[model samples]
Target: MIKIGVLIPEQYKLLSVAAILEVFEAANKFQFASELKETFDITLLTINNQVDSFFKTYKTDTINTEEKFELILIPSFTTNDIKNTIALNRAYIPWLIKQYNSAAEIATFCTGAFLLGATGLLDGKAATTHVDACAAFSAAFPSVQLKADKTVTQDGRLFTSGGATSTFHLLLYLLQIHCGKDLAIKTAKIFAIDMDRHNQSYFSSFQPLRHHNDEIVACAQEKIELNYQDISTIEEMIKDIPSSRRNIVRRFKQVIGITPIEYLQQTRIEAAKKLLEQTAQQMTEVIYNSGYNDPKAFRKIFRKTVGMTPSQYRDKFQAR
Candidate 1:
């Protein structure tokens, strides 16, 4: 059985908390138990037994540390909002770190990544969170490598995700890994979500980076993400680098296996994907906002890379 625990504290983000509940609800309603057996189990844990407005209370003795959960999920809320529970809330940091040290695969959604970060389990892992918290998270835990792209990231035993509904992607990914693709597809269909919507599952190897040297590549990657709207030409990119354009291009291709331009396009497309999933922006607005000045070119490239037009992609992920 795959034991899944949702560590809920006081004053959690409604959407982040809801995402986990909804995924399990979908799993139960979509017949995952009939097909997958007792493979997926969801348990809610808190610091105390008292009920809060954010979630219903479950009995404290219901969870056993020896039960061996395969996954522990933490949802996001303000760090200061956990309320003043000495046993339930305050015990979270130490208890979570202990849980992480066990055999279970640990994960978090949005700022929930902060809880994992506080535990120091992600000190040397690659993870992601909502973009707004990236800089603060980086500064707080300099050892963890944080990426802002896509919804989910897995580094060894740890998995972290970004955006609000990315938690759904995270749960679906676990379902696929533990149960199978067929079960995952079934649950996704029941939710009216597209199975093909961003197929980069957590366990898959990411595409190669474009720069050979870690420092240079990280710098260049950061620049691309930060200045996606302002970047225009290869020469402009080279101007930001201390090395010559020829050397940077050579190193980037050697390390990342793609040209700078290609990486930039991928970045913009990724940005567009997030916007389409999260907002109601028009196609033209998404194109321009993602740094594509020419809407026609954006459409062609988006189609070529994603195998769907921008509108088609948007329609696929937007709530049914």
Candidate 2:
């Protein structure tokens, strides 16, 4: 039996915990029906080893820390403040590091990556979290490679999932790795989860980091967002700024986490998405309006950024 540890941090997102447990519970049922000898043994772990009281909405259970687990799952937290959340749960860091050292695979759901990253184990590894928190995550953990476009990322034994619903995808991935593809598919069908779903790019929006106190970079970002349709917007921005083009580009990248040209392209693609979803515009019109004159170029960039073609996006999300 594979022992799975579900870490129940204080003020955790109850739904994420419940959903994951349900997936495993359903998998157990399937295993029983199939007369499979192997099954998962799940345990609820807490920081204080005392889960005496419920968190108002959900009940919490305590587990013995003496037992070793093959996998440790950290569920998302209800708090938006990553630093505060991490600080509140500082007691778990040493335990988590010990678990990792003992060969336990760590998996984080949504913003739980912040807590996982806090352990210093994710350094030099590719991981992902919720889309909206990508900038903050990147800023906070510079050593970790943040793959915001991916719904799920796994480096070695470390695993992470994007956003709330993407937790199901990560669980399915874990199921496939542990129990095989047949069991994973059976579990996915039981949960009605789409097994083919992979990338989180389709639902992600272009959220540039503007919280940094860089007035010039902020101005450059504003200019790009306002006039992304203009092909020479980058040059115009460079000329309008007081610093040299190279310096401005460097500062923009340092502050905004993306280059000026890349920002411009993302801004344009975001605009194109809005048009495709909200307006009855043709593909050519979307290309031109998004600031790209060439259909091929626009389509290529759109696919690269959004993980789908213009028509596919429109068909999937066109306002009915």
User: Residue-wise lDDT of candidate 2 within 65-117, one digit each (tens)?
Assistant: 66777999999989877798899888888888888889999999999999999
**Candidate number achieving the greatest TM-score relative to the actual structure:** 2
Per-model C-alpha lDDT, please? 0.71, 0.86
Question: Candidate 2: lDDT over CA atoms?
Answer: 0.86
Worst 10 residues of 1 by lDDT: 199-208
TM-score, one value per model: 0.58, 0.89
Candidate 1, 1-320: lDDT as tens digits: 56778876755676777778777767665565476455556777765545455555432322335555678888887553222322234567777777667777888887788777877889888998865556456766889987755578899888888756677788788778876787788877776665544432221212334334567766777787788888977777767678877877887775665678887887888788788778998888899999998988999988766656778877877665
> What ranges in model 1 sit over 4 Å off?
31-36, 53-67, 78-90, 195-320
- Cα deviation at 174, candidate 1, in Å, is 1.0
After superposing candidate 2 on the true structure, give the runs of residues whose Cα lies further than 4 Å from its correct spot: 34-38, 49-64, 231-233
Error of 2 at 115 (Å): 1.8
- Per-candidate clashes come to 4, 0
